[model samples]
Target: MKRIAIIGAGASGLTAACYASGDGRHVLLFEKQKKIGRKLLVTGNGRCNISNRNIIAGHYHGHNSRFVDAVFSRFSLQDTITFFEELGVPFIEEDEGRLYPASLQASTITKVFQYELKKRNVDLQLHRRIERIEYEETGFTLYTAGAEEHRVDSVILAAGSCAFPPAGASNIGYDLARSLGHRVYEPWPVILPVTIPLKSLHQLQGIKWDAAIRVEVNGKEQERSVGELLFTAYGISGPVSLNVSRSVNAAVIAGKSPVVIIDLYPSMSGDDLARRLDRLWSDGGKKTGFSLLGIMKERMPEVLCGIAGVDPEKRVASLTPADKEKIAGTMKNLILEPGKPRGFQEAVAAAGGVDVDEIDPATMESKLVRNLYITGELLDVDGDSGGYNLQFAWSTGAIAGMAQ
Candidate 1:
């Protein structure tokens, strides 16, 4: 049996260890932390979204898409469910195709795998962080933080990206990949909130409104997502913001300033809204701008007034055409200029890693390194929230495991 060393012990690496062991390979899984699955426990807010009902290539963003496609071609969604079932983790799907464990606890899923691996006699090494990987003529030698080394027939770098550094996430995989002669794509903070510099905007922080945000790179529509937009102390956070974060990060990575346009009232046309406001002013017993009912939620009148540079005490009868137009424009589209996003500590996941083109997708094995494989967030692939990213992890993990 070939000796296999799997790094990281997160979802991908542990899954790889299990799969490699199932193939009668002597599998050794190493983790830097005292325990495995720190990141996994945080997924789905501790419920652990295991996979998705709709496993489509469109859901994934990568430097190489075809590689993931090929892996799914071999072991798809059904295979993932079956693998989890065999491990005794029952799962159910919420709305929007997000699948979670029936027990609804990430700890449960992690426990199941830990139990299964022990039952199967897999060597799991926690607190043994790998320092370096040496590709020798016959096999690979892995030096650890504890000053010991393990020689293995192949090394699977399921080592994740640098998102949760506290959880022991690092760029060790990228380091290993480049050291062994593979092109590395630049890593960026993704699935993160955009930080705006204006305190006026920051005052509205924590306010949430349904907004359609469009990210532009040099006047080009790079990304768009429409949903609840959250105002933050530093900038914006929310579903729409997180979804478009990839485009923003990508532009920044390409050395361009990322710009975002927000439509606070995307569903309602600005002209119609203005006309309605004008009508309300004339008919509502001559109500003041600040006291105008139904213009928005009660708490928002003051903010809108500030944005339009209007007196809150001004009566609707006294509101000029210029005033109405400015209000309409502000409500329609608010321009938010952002600085760099919060680092990996605040990110859901890092953006880039091992280039998939350097590996065979069907097996996830390195094209240059014999028997070496790649999987999970370690590969340069990310997905939108709503559990898509966790699903990618489980799907990629299952595929890599099955391949071994």
Candidate 2:
């Protein structure tokens, strides 16, 4: 039997081990952490979003983002669903095609994987970190942290990126790839909250509104998203901020300031909002400006009125057309200048990794080194929030495992 060594034991590593085992092959799965699937357990706030129904190349981003097309073509979304179902994990679809295990517990997926790996007789070595790998024409020799050596016929590097450090995320995967002559891009934290220094906005912390957001870098529109907008004491979060976080973080890394423009009432046009405000004012009978602005959250009206230079205590009937216009405009185009993104400790995924150009997208095998595969967030490709990243992980891991 040929010995195949796989590193990381993460979402991709676990998937690869299951597929690579059997057929006269012995798979050795190594993880530096004490437990397996630490990162997977915390995904989707512990619910574990396994994949997305809408898995497309467009949802992913990287220098060679189109590379995902070839990988997905080999292992499509249906294949992922079927693979998990076969392992006894049925899925439930949530909003935006996000798929989660019916149990709604991340531990369910990890436990099933553990059971399956044990049944397959795959060697799962937890708390054993592969410090370095030495490849030769004969095969490959892996060096563990204790200087123990293990020789294998093939190697798969499924070590994930440094996204959430608390979940055993590290740069060891990049180091191993670089050791083997692969170009590793400096990783940046994406899919996290962005910090804005506006004190007025910070006062509105804990307020969430359904809004539309557009991110601009150097006055050029980068990305747009529509969803819940959350105000944090530090800045903004929620789906709207997370969707555009990649663009905002990239700009900060490039030494340029990024702006996030929010539309509080995305479904309403500026003219429509103005008309609504007119109606509200006309119906006001001895009501204060703050009372008439009851369309939003309790404390939001005062902050917005302050920003628009309108007195919240002023009588609605005393308000001029100019005051109404200013408030309407402020709501329509609420500009926020973002500071820096929260670090990888808070990020759901990372943007950069081993350059995809060095890997075969179809097989996920390294073009520079034969029989060596790289998969998961360790690669350059990263997807948008809402289960896209995990979908990519499943596809790439399945492809690499099935590759000869």
Candidate 3:
């Protein structure tokens, strides 16, 4: 039987090992971490968002998204659900098509992969970091950091991208791809917090609420996301911010200015908000500005009053129509200047990696090297903050696993 060597026991590496081993091939899965799935365990805050119900094309970003479409078509979101179910792991669908294990534990997903690997007779190696990878006429030889050598008929570089070092993420994937004559784009942080200079944001620290945000590059709106926004001491985090961070990073990489405009009241238009303020003034006579807008957090009214140039000490009934309009506009549009993306340690994933132009989308094999396959974040493809990234891992891994 031909031997297959898969580097990195991540979600993609684990999936590739299962498929390649099941095909009557001897599979060796190597991991640098002490245990498998260190990153996976922390995914979705330990709940493990396995996949998403809506795994469409628009959710993914890359130089050539057609590659993702082709790979995902082969193994879809439903296929992923069914595959997990067959492993005796049930799941539940949460908001925005996010899927979590029924046990609400990420360890469950890792355990299922472990059981499958054991049953398939795949050899699992841990704490073995490949230091040198050399391709020969026959096959490939991988030398680990400990000076151990491994030879296999095929090599699948699923080592993942360098984003979260604490989780054992490394740059080995980029090194290996470049060694094999493939172009790799500089990696950038994605799905991470955005640093802002607004000192007022400090007042809203630890506050969590829903909002709609649009990313603007050089005064041009690039993308928008809507979800819960969490204010932090450094900047903003949460679903909406994380979703649009990729665009912000791209703008920065291109030397362009990126800013985020947030709609605090996404559900209400400017006119509706103004009408609501007018009604509040009529209902609550002789109330301070802060007291009139006390429906939200007390700090929020003060911040809004400052942004709209309204006096917190002024009575709501004493406000003119123009003051009400200004307040309404401030609530509808909160502009913020963004700094650089959070460091790789805080990023959920990286935006750029092995260029897809040198990769075959149908088979996921490196076009520049024979029997050299690539998968997961090692590729340029990145998805939104939901379960899309994990789904991409599974799909690409499966295709490479079944490669002839």
Over 4 Å off, model 3: 283-289, 317-320
The collision pairs in model 1 are none
Question: Could you tell me the TM-score of candidate 1?
Answer: 0.91
Q: Any idea what lDDT model 2 has?
A: 0.89
- Across 1-404, the per-residue lDDT of candidate 1 in tens digits comes to 87888888888887776776765677788888888889989877678877778788887888777766787777777877888888888779886678898999999988988897797778989888888888977999999977798988888888888887867778887887788887777887888888878666777777888889998877888888888888888888987888888888777767898788888778888777777766667654454555555756654666666766876677777777787777677677776667776799878888778888887777788898877777788788887777766666666666666666
lDDT ranking from best candidate downward: 2, 3, 1
Model 3 local distance difference test score: 0.87
TM-score of each: 0.91, 0.96, 0.95
Q: What's the lDDT for all of these models? A: 0.78, 0.89, 0.87
- What is the alpha-carbon RMSD of candidate 1 to the true structure? 2.5
**Stronger candidate by TM-score (2 vs 3):** 2
> Which is superior by lDDT, 2 or 3?
2
**Pairs that clash in candidate 2:** none
Model 3 vs. true fold: TM? 0.95
lDDT score, residue 214, model 3? 98
Q: Pick the candidate with the highest lDDT.
A: 2
Candidate 3 residue-wise lDDT, 21-45, digit = tens: 8666889999988899889999998
- What lDDT score goes with residue 323 in model 2? 83
